[model samples]
Structure formats: structure tokens, C-alpha cells
Target: MAVTTSPVDETAIGELKAEVRGPVLQPDDDGYDEARTVYNAMIDRHPGIIVRPTGAADVIAAVNFAREQDLLVAVKGGGHNVAGLAVCDDGLMIDLGLMSSVRVDPDARTARVGPGARLGDLDHETAPFGLVAPAGVVSITGVAGLSLGGGFGYLCRKHGMTVDNLLSVDLVTADGDLVHASEDDHPELFWGIRGGGGNFGIVTSFEFELHELEEVLAGLIIYPADEAHSVVRSWWEFISEAPDELSVWLNFSHAAPEPFISEEYHGERILSVIPIYSGNVEEGWDVIAPLREVGDPIADTVEPRRFVDWQQAFDESYPAGERYFWKSHNFKSPSVEALDHITDYAVSPPTPDTRVSVTHLGGAVNRVPSDATAYPHRDADFLVNITTRWHDSTQDDECIAWTREYFDVLAPHATGGTYVNFTTEPEGEQSMAYRENYERLVALKNEWDPDNLFKMNQNIKPTS
Candidate 1:
């Protein structure tokens, strides 16, 4: 009843490899297995070929070769995509992990970052200058994919979504030409790329306007697990009245087995209120004290730290090569019932690494009009993410089912629309996720890539 697809064309793949200026890995190459790996260990795709492009010219060459060979091609920035769109089975993968350059123009308050650059690289570069870009909370996330997907971070309340700060992007189109797209150049493409994911082309580099942020008062305050319900409720009411300069993410999980954590507390359920204040330290403490006082906290680690240090706060817990499954939903309101639902399941997370995070998404993020870019959920107060992590395949079902059930329980409270970056690869969900933006994206796809050469991502099929 079903037709099975065959393997990639060996001859064409071999030819394509020769065109890249950097290393090209074939199925039998020594580094082939490693090259095809993405951040999520759950995704194990075998591409026809993997090429690491060194620069814009290299990316152009790979794009042209893939188009000529009529091969499915995927662009991998940080390979941190939850859906694993960065690498596809039997497709050509343009791995950009090697391009990690970040050049900051302090005078212009802007930075030009390579596609392969990770959030950690960008943060480290900008930290010295007392400036930073709003990126994912996890430092290892690729700057390009996160930016293109309308990234939100701790600074989102004060600054804006990552796309809001995006100035321009250097893209290699399906036609094999390298072009710069910004507000003034290729305006249509620029608008689409901001929150559109990588539907149109492979972005070689991104230019973003940086924010002036110095020693930020940021860290976590951990309370007893039993107080999670009250703490989350208090947080919802408190953060809603917080000034734009203050943003806090609520996390409910077990204390991890890290060196910083006490041995007795490891695997014990805990309630943590992680806040970042983009303001003076003294004033920030005054604002954060109420949260620490909510329930008798077992530990209070909140203090003044560099912005980059705060960005990498979760790095140790979310190290690479682990099985990671996460789901996110934006909320118009944090109803009391939602908090109860979240804590009910959070009490027994499948793994110690499991986390339930509530990210504040209004303030600067909502200031931008809904129609300005492809990211449309502008009125949401908070975006809740259900994350599951485990090291063994035996526990895969347990971890995945937990995340799914958690979202299922809170479905009524969820704002139906999805953020492109946080979406899953299931067929019907994606189309309905980007509802209104769907038509505009389809039109843009037809104009730029009618052949669907870039259909490997959160796809927007061309309408003929």
C-alpha cells in the first residue's frame, strides 16, 4: 500500500562533496557518523552527505550543488532544533557548526555573527563590552536557528524577541546566489526570515542590534517542592506587575546531581524562581526579595552576575548528546488551575533532568505588532515549556509520554498558536500552528523557492 523511497544518489553526492571549500563527509567517511549528529540524541538521521561550509562562498557552492543534483537539502546551524530539521534522512546536510565568529560593533551597538555561532560564543563576545543579545536561555543553542525562529530569552521582557533585534541576514537562496536581506534590501525576504525559521534559504550570517547590559542581578532561589503551587501562583501575580526591566522564569524540578547541589537534596523535588534584572543591583534585589521570602527557601543563590554567566546557567544540566524532548505553549493568562495541573505532574518527572519552565513573554516582546513579522503570538503573558531528558533509550517512552501528558493536561489553558522554533514535526500540527502566517509564508515560498528546495524545516508549501 505504500511506496518506499530509495537511497541518495552516490555519484551526485560525491560530486557535491568536491565543490565545498571545507570538509565534506560521505556515508563511509571517518567523521560521517559524528558530522550528522544533532544536539538531540533522540534524532538519529543519516544524510546522503554532510558538508561544513567555511564562509558565504562555501555555502553558495553547496546550495548550487544540492539544487543541481535534485537532492533534499537541510541547513544545520547549531543542530539544536528539537524536531531535528537540521539533518534529514537521505538529504544533503549543510552543517554550519564550524562557523563560529562574532564581531561586535560597539559604536553601532550591533554585532555580525556567523550562522554556526552558538549563543555561548555570542554571549562571551558581547559580555566584555557590557552588551548582549537576547537569545535562548541555554547557551549552546545556535544563534541563527534561534534568531530565525523568533527566539525568546530572560531579556525578552526588557528587550524583545531575538527577531526584534535582528538587523539583517546574509542568505544563500535556492537559486544559488548569496544576498543580504534587511529592511532596506530584499525587504520581503527579510521580513519572512525574522520569525519564519529557515523556510526560504540558508542563512550564512546574522546582524543584530545589541543591548546595553552590564552586571545583571540574576540567579535562582529554591523553595520546597510542596510550595510550588503557591510560589507559581504568586509568581504569576507578581511578574504581571513587574517593570519591563525585570523578568523571571519559574522552574519546578528535582535538584540535579551536580557538584554545586548538596548530596542530600539530589533528586528531591524543588521550586525555583530564577530572575534576571536588567537594572541596578540594589534595586533588583529589592524587587526579587519578595519571591525569596514566599516560602522558606532551602537555598538562595540569586546575586549580581555577568549577563553571559546567567545565559550559561543551565549548560551543565543540558549537556549535549542527551535524549531531549520538549514542548512549549504560550498562555494568555496563568490561571490558578494551570499551576495546579503543572505541579501535579512535575512532582514525579521521568528524569531528574526534567524541567518545567514558565517564561514571561510580554513587555518588549508584545510591543511589536502581530503582523510585523511571522511570529504572531504577541499577547501571550507567559510561554510554558515542558522538557524531558534521559540518557537511556529504555526510558525514552517514559520521558516522552510525560512531556506529552503534561501538555495534554494543560491544553485548555494553552494559546493554540505555536512558535515556529518550538514546534514539533508532526504533520497537521505545524500547518495549524502558524495559521495566519501560513498564507503569507506560502506566497513567499512560491516567489523564492517554487520547487520546495528548502522544504526540510517547519515547511510552508508553495501555492501555485
Candidate 2:
């Protein structure tokens, strides 16, 4: 299905460029190609005009212009969304890449960050103050998309999801007004944006409560692929009873040909566990000792390292330009039959780089009430994500089919709810992402954006 875009008008493009502080790019402009590129190489979208906003004023102007022109709008923060909602055909794209900045207040224990700031950028700014904001594991992931969809990471068990720490947000609403949302003002809108995806508005900046986190005992432990079934079972049992300070994730994928991994095990399917302890490092060793003894470990990198460093450890695996497809499911518990199905798929991925990951979700994450925010899957025990990656476009059909088939087999065992951030396509499953909160979200959507102007994301349709 090819998208037909309205023809670009030269006079309108010239006027839009003069209205903002940053550059406005057309298809033939110098940086147009670079401006439209996103994290997933599989996404190739061409917008009629791309506006690089310097700050909130620029964003306001862009939004107003788009509304006046009756054009669709796509907001690009870090360009890290796997679904590529940041770029759209024939729409106006507001690029915030130049607005990346992080300001931390040590005394207040808070950080004010630009929407374009990546997780690494936030960590780099706050780590010096012995403070950290709970964010996603990938450093390159944009803060806006992650937080909007309910962020979870190494620190999630200790603190909570990123939205749990969010203090306030500054956004450009459908009416092109710059509004502030916090508990004190516009509280309902604030709650909606916490885990509601980007169906509400364009967030320009975010304020988050930071936690005292200096260093952590974090790294990976790998075992043979044949031990996946037992290893997974052991991990589930251990994590279920583990302390809140410790967070661990299990991955089943072929070993990367990295120097840290043994050459003999390279390219072979393997099961690995990444554990992070935000508490006393010495005590962590004792708590994690049992996990190390699982199935004749092949490689162990667990050690005391800076939290920021550990966040970037997996950066190389997910580079900027790679065809990626991901499917996610939230499970209340991992049944034996489900584990067996996962193990079978893990050992036989369509691509060597394909991976199946199980992230333990409990502790502080579950402490928050389900109705407190729009992200309402607090009762979930684990989040299972299947990431399919391939460099060649020719392999798209087979790789995508394998991911869907894998999901089809596992869906029966899943809770039928999904994480909005991991959703790749905007289909009928949109309501499932929000579950029981879907109707309330729709009501809020009607109040905030009655015309559904921000329909590019996991759309929560306004009532007719």
C-alpha cells in the first residue's frame, strides 16, 4: 500500500521556514534525507516538510502552521521509535533532535530534560550528582516515547517505571497552545500522558524525580542454549522472591561474535541473564550467587560498574540502521507450556541476531495502583519481547512471518495486554494495549484532542 502525499507548495514552504528559529526542509533540501531517517532502517517515510524546532516556541509555531494547513503532524524526538511514528508521509514533521538537553537540580533531587534527550543523555547529566532517573535499557532510546509508553529498566524494580518519577510535562496541544501538565494543574491530562502513548499531544520537556544511584553490580551471565528451559524456570523462581534492589532479564539469542564471549560459543544459540543490583554491591554478590551456578556458565561479565556504563553495554547490538521487528506480550506468570514454546523458538530463530527476552516485572513496579496512571498492567509478572533483526530487505517476509507465528503460539498463554512502546503496527489491537482503561482513555482523548489530530501513534479514538 503506497501512501499518496499532497504536492509540496514552494510558497508555503518558504513561509514556514521564516516562522521558526530552526531549519525547514523539503525533499530536495540538503539535510532532508538525514532529518527523515529513524532508528529502524525498515521504516522509510517521506514527509512533505520537516521542521527542526529549537525550543517550545518553534514547536508551537510548527503545530499552529500544521493545523492551519490542515496537514497531519508527526513529532520526532530521538527518532528511536521502532514503529517510526515520528515520520509520516505528506505530514509536517517537527524534529526536536537539536533540543536535546538535561538539567539536574541536586538540592531538589529532580531533572528537567528536553523531549529529544536520549536515555544516555539523561544518565550522563544526572550520574555526576549521584542521581539517576529510571529509564529504558537502551541508551539511544528517546525519553519522550519511552516515558509516554511507561518506561521500565534496570532501576525499575528498585524505584518504579519512569512515569512513576515524572513530575511534570510541557506540551503543545492540538489547539497549538503551550500547556503545562502536572499534579497541581491539568492533573487529568498529566495522568493520561503518563502511559497513554503519544495520543494526547507533543511533549517538549519533562521533569522527573531523580534517585540516589552511584554505582551498581550489573553485567551478563550466559549458558548453553540447551539449558534454556531449566534456566528460565530457575530465573522465574529466583526473581519472584528476589529483593527490590535487584533486577534481572533473561535473553535467548545466538551469541554475538564479540571479544568478551568465547570464540567457540560464538554464533551458537545461548541463554543469558543480565542482573543489576542498585543496593550494596557486596550484598548483591551473595544474592546473585545462586543464579551464577545455573547450567555450566559459558561467559560471565558480572561486576561492579557505573550505572551509566552498564546502560550503554548493549548499544552495539542494536545499531541505528537495521531492519527491526518486535512483538511483545505481558504475562501474569510463565506457564511450563509457554516456557517450552519460548525455548523451541529461541533455539531456532530466523536470523542469528533475533532474540527472545523476558524481563522480570515486579517489586516497586507493582506497588503503583493500576488506575493511578494510564499504564495499567502493574499486575504483570513478566514482559516477553521477541525482537527480529535482519540487514537484508529480501528477508523481510520470512522474518516477519516467524515473529507473527511465534506470537500466535504464545498469545494464548499471555495476558492479552501489551506494552504500547513495543507495538509496531496500529491495528485493532490498539484497545488491547490499554485494556480496561481504553474507554476512559477515549473519553480523555475526546476532551484533549476531539478531532484526533495526533492520530499517528497508538490511536485512542475520540468518541463520535
Candidate 3:
């Protein structure tokens, strides 16, 4: 005989719909399928109910209802998480899609943003003021998840990670209480949320300290695949003494079929470097000259461009619904042997969409004290991510194995620490990601959320 689970009560769902202003969706609802779809196509979960919350009150109502019904709760902001933490099977999903909004205070040099806002939405609102909040490279990523995981991008070297710019956060706690966390109020919760993942609550809004940024000298520069080892060596040396105003990331992958790239190099394995100078354009030109002179280049798009334009440069490559598997490591430095191993993998990728990115991480990122927040890897010199993307589900095992193998080969050179945002598993090597702060975070988790209501993310379980 086969067993079947009981369905959620329709009467209870109706009561929830009447209590909240936003729409409540059940499995049979018209928009339920669309609401449950996340950024990664690899995840296919059917939540019991989907709540589209328009404001904090709706979130409070949804959380309370889930608690009363003893149902698991999953929160979705932009739903861009690689691990698909935003959706859960047979649970209630609190979708914040309708709450996308941004309010900038030019005089205060700060912006208050809704949790559902993407990087592009925040950038569009802040660009007119010649200010921006330091965020990740992908524009579609949610501000809440990125900031909570310690965001890094082109401006990271110049200013700092996104969490460093965070001024305040408004969240709904496990017990359905609305609270404001900052340096002054609920100081402990604020510290935990900084690079702590979503272990404590559902953050509804974020206040960020914006920095003045206008145009930047930035673009992509591609070199032949054979020169990868030498190019990496040169880049490593240059970054050792590079100014804080500049940030660069090296990509080892096949060349894309784009108008800017030469047709002959399309689909060919190549070494590409993206350098962005967030200072004076004239000085930036002088500083980036050596990088252009590296080996014989196939194509170069390095020139002056708007900072907003540079942020969205890689948007097209990472479209929604693509099957993506990622593995990352934090390293103080890479040895010559490691570079050679990386070159070997780059020369023969499982798919054309697979890419290995090495991002320099020493300027402002290293300046922050490790104990200041839950993010503890403050001294890492570089962050390496192995991304494997493919179209077919049948190729899942192959792509995943390749990513793991690549990480294993380079593990010897890594610092045993990984970025919380890049981790694909729910429970990562906790000690590595949190370092000495793991136990402290667990204690905080116990204090804030004893029941572990927000266990959908990279979870930090309560110690008690």
C-alpha cells in the first residue's frame, strides 16, 4: 500500500487571505506555479501556499499564520539564490515580489530599500544622485540576500562590501514581531544578520549608506587561452600593489558570441579580465595600461563607461531558469601549481557556459576587522568561484562532479573558508564560513529564534 500526505486546509487559507491585504495562493491557484518558480531551474519545489506580501504587516500575518499551522516557512525576495533557499517543498512561501521600492535621501547620502528590490532597481533610483550602494555584479540579485551575505563587486575594493555600507534593517521575527535592527537598536541581531545569512528573521527593508560614484573606466580584455598561466601570474603580481580605486576579476572560459568579440574567437577557450577603475578616468587609463599590454590580446573593450552600465555587463550571461552549480574558496594567495591546475581545467570545460572566476579581494575587504561582524574572512587575498551551467537535466551529475572536482584540486591552496552567498548546500562547513564566530552565531540564533523558523537558508542552528 502507498501512503499519501494530507492537504493543507482550504478554510484556514481563506481566513489568512481575509486577514492579509496581499493575495494568498494555494496549490490550485492560477498563479501558484509562476510564484513558486525560482532563478535556478534545478530546483522544482511545490509549496503548500504562496503569500504575496505587499508590506511588513502582510509579512507579520503570514509568519503568524505559518506558526499557528505548524507549517515550514520559506521566504523569497528576488529568488536568485543558487541553492534555491527561497522555496521549500510542502511549505508556505512568503513572496515579497510586490514590495519592490527604493527611497533615496540625497542630503543624508543614504537609501532605504524594500527587501524585494533588486540591484538594478536600487541603482536606477540612486544613479541620479551620483551615489550607489556597493553590491554584487549581477543586477537581478536581491538586495536583502546579497547584503546579508556580505556583498562584493567592482566597488568593494574602493569602498567595502555591501554589509559594511548597511545602516539599518527592518525585519519580522520568528514570533511575528516587527523589529528594527541597527548599530544602536537590537545591536546583536544587526551584527548577526551581517554576513550571517537568513537565520534569525525575514528582513523587510534595508537602509544603506551610499557612496558617490559616477563614471568608471572599465570593460573586458580578452587574451589567448595559451597565455592564461602567464596572464594570471601577471594579474596576481599587479594586484599585490594595485591601488584601492581599482578592482579586477579574471575569467577562464570559452569566448562568447557577442558583437564586441571577434567572430574568429567565438566559442574558443580564452582568458578574460574585467578591470574597473572607480577614480579619475585619466589616471585610470594610466593605471590600466599594463593590463592591456599583457601578452597578445584578441580583443579589448577596456574604456570609460558608466558605473551602472558596468554593473549590468554580465546580466545577459546569467539568465533566469538556467541550471547552475557553483563552488567557491577563499585564498590568501594562489601558488604556481594551483594556477597550472586552473589552466588545465579551463582548457577543457564540460560545457561552453562553465566558467572559473578569480576575483581579487584585498583592498577594503581586508581592512575590516574579522570580529566586527559575522563575516570572518577579512584577510583573504582572492575569492575563486567555479560555476558550471548547462541546459539539460540529464547532464546534472556531470556538471556537478566537474565543479566539485575543480574545487577539490584547488582546495590545498584555499583558506578553508567560503562565501555564504556562494554556498549551494544548506549546511556548509560552518567553521570555515563563520571561522571563530560560528559558536557565537549559534548562540545568537538560540536567543533570537529558538525554534529555527528560518532554516531554509544556510542555517545556523540554535546551540541550546
Candidate 4:
């Protein structure tokens, strides 16, 4: 192995500028601060330089250049990492934000997307063809990071995880080789890449199997806050036996003073269910009628809508600007006692923007064998994500404490394993997130990258 002791040379800088198509924004550049920023405003990293590569060739050059200097490399796809691992201090940052192109195969029902594409960009391109991929529910999440972290979305019930639909990927490995991976080629690497975060390589492009998701009967159905117990109990019963075509997400929060919500409900705690029915609209209507008729909903906005429209529904409320502290747990069931705990927290949340959300975790996601990929929680019924969102940095301690307390209170119900996508702390609990799969991940890490060049993610140590 070779290493350079001298500081970044002028010739090396010139070589980098010549290879990349996009701008190489250094600390002196005008957009350096904005370019290096992740979605969370709380991340205050100052990378030595940020390289926005335009294509695989550019990415290869960037990877090789960093390797030559033995510098740390941080790969930023959607910049939505809660732990802010996308950027690092005194390291080389590879920003893939410019690779936002989507190419759809309408006849085959598939799409080949660039690594920089967001969920919204992919949806808008594929929806016109009456096709969709299992991307994140939020529109702004990057396809690369989300898909690699084992994407969970509204379509998981009808379809599967984003990684489950992944047909192939074009990645630049630690050796700076641009290789294509699929079931037919480098299958083990493909399997590891499906849910392995940024541990193996930097993905430049992805080929995913899309579904014919033309019309969706989806939106929010809000019930009064006090009625959470009844609604949640009925919801638990209704979803347990509901057909595979329906996927529902539950939320408890103070009603925002938006135009769609009633004025009287503003600032009042409420329970809302966001459902996406992938089958016929009439069938969806029949499936969700039980909840609508159970209580006097402050609002019921479920109806037949374009698939693209439904994907962007939550973007406004959870924008990129807010500081966030998130904690998550996977449960065997949404027991009444668990609902009781959530209800107790909802009435008096730490902040107005604080929320507790439940995402259905069964269906195609559970069909995969537990050791098939890096994602573990195969048998869990629901994923409970407790988030504390506030605008001011002064509230950081209070917000994080509230999230920790909620997780502590609900710990009795949790199965101990967690979803790494929603994980923040990268310590003891983080190690448990992978469950029994941690050993296998270590072997894969050693085989592909012994030096830990890609150690800037939810790290799976080579010796762990």
C-alpha cells in the first residue's frame, strides 16, 4: 500500500478538477457551506472539500484520488441521515446530489435511476407510465441512501422493500473499480448492498423493478385526540386480518393549523391514520370504512388520487429545516398496553412538533429470510418511530431527552432489535440493531473492504 505524507498537492487538485463534470467546491468556494450541508440543520461538519460528481467516471476519479492520499471519504446521497454521517470533518466529501436522472422502461415496468435522485424525482418520472418503486414515504429522501438502508414505504404491503425490487446496481468499490452487480454477477455483493448501507461501495446507478401503481386511495383520516384508545384498538384489529393490498401508518400529534384541518382542531392533540390501498379504489374504500365510521373524524381526506400526489403529502410538515432527534423500536404486536403508552405521551408531548408514528412491518418485508440481508427485524409487526422536532438549537437537550424517555417507557414492548434507517446513536444499541446478522456483515466487510475505506456509515466492524 502506498501513502502520501505531503498536503493535497496542486497537481492532484488539478487532476480532480479535470476529471469531474460538476463543480469541485472547496472551503473557499461560494457554495461550499450550502453544498456540504445535509438535510438536518443540526449537522455542522466542515469537510475539507466537496466533490459533486456527474457520472460514474467522475466518481471513480474521486474515489481513487481520496484513496491515494489515505483520506477519509464521506458519501452523501440524499443527505437525510439522522446521524449526519453523510459529511465529515477534514475529510473528502463526495456529494452525489447532481445525479438526479430517472430512466423508465414502461413495457418492462422498471426504472434505471441515478444515485442522486430523490423519491419525488423518481415518482414523477415513473408515475406517468403507471409504474412505481418502493421508495420512502417522504418525497425528498435520496434514493441511494434510502434504498441501500432497506427502504420501507406505503407500498411494502402490496409490493416489497425498495431493495427487494432492486435488479442491479453500478458501484465504485474501494479499489476504484466501476462494477455492475446483480444476481448473475457478484451475487453476494448484491445481497449485501441491498440493505448494507454504505459499507461496501459507492453506488452510482440502480436498476429497480417498478410496479403498476396507477391509482391509489390514500390520505389522512384524523380522529379527535381523546379517541386514540378506541381508534388504535379498532385499527389494530382491522389491520391484523386486512388483505395484503392495504398499508397504513398511524400518527399522534397536535393538529397543525393548516387549511385542510378544521380551525377548532388547531393546537389540539389528534390521532391520524394514513392509509395507502394499492388495489381498486372501491375495494380500498371498503377496507377503510370501519375506521371512518368509528368516530367523528375532524377530517377524512382519503380518496382516489394519483400515486405521485400521495407520495408528496407529508413533505410540508417534515421539511428539511427542522432539527430532529429520532428513536425507534420494533414490536411483535401493537398491544393495547403499547397504545396506552402512546396515548399517554400524545396528550402532553414535549414540543408541538413532537410525534409518535407507527408503520406496518409485516407483508413482503417479513417474507424474506432473516439472514438474507443486513436488515434484521423480520417478524416484527410494527415499527414505532418517536421523533422530537424543533426549530431552535437551544431545545436540543430537552428534545433528545424526551425521545430517550419515550423509548425507555416503550422498551418493555420492543423486541430489542431496531431499524437502522431510523437509528441515530452508533454505540451499544446500534450494534444490537443488526441482531444476529452482525457476524455475517463482518465477514462481508473483510472480504470486500479490509481497510474499512467505507467505514463512514452504520459501521459493521470487520472483527465484531
lDDT of each: 0.83, 0.88, 0.88, 0.84
- Candidate 3 per-residue C-alpha lDDT over 370-461 given as tens digits, one digit per residue, 9 for 90 to 100: 98888888988888888788999999999988888888887888888888888776324677789889988999999988888888888887
Displacement of residue 145 (Cα, Å) in model 1 is 0.8
C-alpha-based local distance difference test score of model 3? 0.88
Give the worst 10-residue stretch by lDDT in candidate 4.
Answer: 1-10
Top candidate (lDDT): 2
Error of 3 at 122 (Å): 0.6
Error of 2 at 132 (Å): 0.5
Per-residue lDDT of 92 in model 4: 85
Off by over 4 Å in 1: 1-18, 257-263
Candidate 2: what lDDT? Answer: 0.88
lDDT value for model 1: 0.83
Model 4: CA > 4 A from native: 1-7, 427-430
Tens digit of per-residue lDDT, candidate 2, span 1-464: 12226865678777777888999988888999999999999999999999999999899889878877778888898899889999998888889998899999999999999988999999999989999999998899999999999999988888999999999999889888999999998999999999998888999999999999889998889998887888888888888789999998988888888788889999899988989999999999999999888777888999999988888988877788899998898888778888788778987999998888888889999999988999998998889988899999999999999999988888999888888888776535667888878888999999988888888888888876
The Cα error of candidate 1 at residue 316, in Å, is 1.1
Q: Ranking under lDDT, best-scoring first?
A: 2, 3, 4, 1
Which tens-of-lDDT digit does each residue in 378-450 have in candidate 4?
Answer: 8887888887788898899988888888888988878887777787775364457778877777788898877
Candidate 2: deviation at residue 270, Å?
1.0
Residue 190 error for model 4, in Å? 0.9
